[model samples]
Target: MHPVCEVPAPGESLAEVGGVNVHAGPAIDGRDRRRLERLCRYVARPPVAQERLELTPERQRLVYRFKHAWRDGTHAVVLHPHDLIAHFDYRKSKLGMAGR
Candidate 1:
């Protein structure tokens, strides 16, 4: 599947992608239904919880790895689907720059 270009805003239950309006309620038939189905499938799917932490961005790649346990410690990083999509887009631009 092709990557989605525009990411919807937070708390946005409905949106229009590639000229197709996706919302709740009854489903229509034909191409519109198919488009809506695709949209629902993509959005309904949960985001990948796994994320790589980068320590450096240079000729030599570096990633941060942690392995420790505390008596009562907690860590959390909240990320929305749009954030991940934007990150990928940013990386693509960086890659293009690296080639130059």
Candidate 2:
């Protein structure tokens, strides 16, 4: 994972250490149409793309490749097909809420 080097807007703070990044971005500008649209598009994007998802060669487990490798050096997640469904089902809401 590369360290986050984004410069935050005024009044916002951005920091990263050892590939972990934390940022408190400026408050949302509801009046900014472009920004609002960008945020909406991001939230509505698919959680996983078909290209990044595949069944393991043995056909017993699924592998999900990440767009970027994690700081821990994990490039993909391996799971049983059933477990994958359960994981997605647990994230039930449009707002990415888990469980209830």
On TM-score, the candidate that comes out on top is: 2
Question: Model 2, range 7-72, lDDT digits (tens) per residue?
Answer: 656566787754335665646789999988887787688877878999888989999999999999
Q: List per-prediction Cα lDDT, in the order shown.
A: 0.50, 0.75
Lowest lDDT block of 10, candidate 2:
91-100
Residue pairs in candidate 1 whose N, alpha carbon or C atoms collide under 3 angstroms = none
Residue 40 CA error for candidate 1 (Å)? Answer: 33
Candidate 1 has its poorest 10 consecutive residues by lDDT at 59-68
